[model samples]
Target: MSTEENSGALPLPQDDPVVSAGLDIAMRWGAALGGPEKLKIAFEALEPQLKREHQLRLKQLDMQREATARAEENAREAAERMVRLAQQKRQHALRMTGLWLGAGVSFAMLVAGVYVARDMWWLSLFLWGPSLLAMAKLYTLRRSDPGDMQAVTLGMRSAANAAQQAPPPPVP
Candidate 1:
């Protein structure tokens, strides 16, 4: 109640009588309980439980880390499988296109050779010879390794060049 009694105490924003009364009670209780020593003993009793809880939390964190790593590895493997499947599909399409083109060209050349044989024997030889050579080249291409990127690129370039040299479609 006197200023001397509150000297060492911090100034309260509001001079609440109830707050001062509660603080006084708390100080008395603290002194009766042997102050810091009782609190230290309470904490020491709780040490083992706190350590067990900490170890459990660390184990949970480790498990979560392992799960994340496994998930990432699975995702990576799935992505790789998708890429490989796409490459296989592309190679299959190219092979099918090559087969169809080779068959059509050979058939067309044979028909033309037969039609031109009686009139121009030399033209027939030219047509049939080129068709045979083209077939032989295709056979060699099929026999070669499909995994070779350089061979695949060369084949694509040659096809592009042949397309460029081909005559344009007649206007409608």
Candidate 2:
């Protein structure tokens, strides 16, 4: 047979004994078994196995896609949680700052009242009463809430009350 007929369409390496031997055996078998018809039957027999492999590969790809989607969803949830936590922290900070400012203003008013009492006693009384009442109301409102801030407000109110009851310092 011609080299082209022996090797079919592809060129066989004459230098490789193993390849040449395998090809020779295949060629002989093809001839013995009716060649093209036997090859077609062999390919048909292998089609199911090839299809199973393709299906398995598709399933693996689907699983990987689901895993990637889950990971992305988890990341999104985590980011949203972090944003909520940050917003809560900012809100707490603003609340605390407001509480501090309120307390400071009340205390300043009380101090001003005490200093002014040295001369204008009635006007000082007017300032002191309102400041004390505001402090008391603030403390009461905060005390209803359960936190360290509540305790701090209670302490501040008690100190203010104590200062209000104490005798004025002797005039210099």
Candidate 3:
């Protein structure tokens, strides 16, 4: 440190009644800091650590945001899957009801056709043909659709299925 630069930098406050006021206080503080150049160097030296901490905080926030978004997306997808499964179940119930009704009607007609066969053979044939077709359709229909409900985690479901399918333990 140069003697001229270091000598008498920050003057102590005088023991006078008159306050040195704003400019005087500022000059004293600036002199205590050694100069504007050293102040600049101090700030420059501290900036990298401050900047790194700021970036780290921002990265943490971004990670949290991304995780939340992924969770919401997974929830949304699960909800959609549930809705689709419910719709499919509703449609299946409706189809099964219709098919059961048709089967009942056809079976009734077949019985009626047998009673009518002895009286009017041609009329019985007319009723029998369509009844047979309806029965055939009911019997040939597939019970399950190709697109069945898929679970993300089948832990409980698989356990239940296994329990149901496994042979009962011998009564001890």
lDDT (0 to 1) per candidate: 0.71, 0.74, 0.67
Off by over 4 Å in 1: 1-35, 139-172
* Candidate 1 C-alpha lDDT tens digits along 1-172: 7543756976665478897898678666657777757857867898999999999999999999999999999999999999999999999898888878777777787889799776555556656663445563574356544444455455556555755675654567
Tens-digit lDDT string for candidate 2 (15-65)? 999988987897787788787789789879999999999999999999999
Clashing pairs in model 3, backbone N/Cα/C closer than 3 A:
none
Local distance difference test, candidate 2: 0.74
TM-score of each: 0.61, 0.57, 0.55
Candidate 3 per-residue lDDT, tens place, 40-146, comes to 78778999999999999999999999999999999999999999999999988988887787777778878887997765555466556643554545544633332
**TM-score of decoy 2:** 0.57
Superposed model 3: Cα runs more than 4 Å off? 1-38, 134-172
Best by TM-score: 1
Kindly provide the TM-score of model 3 when superposed on the true structure, using C-alpha atoms: 0.55
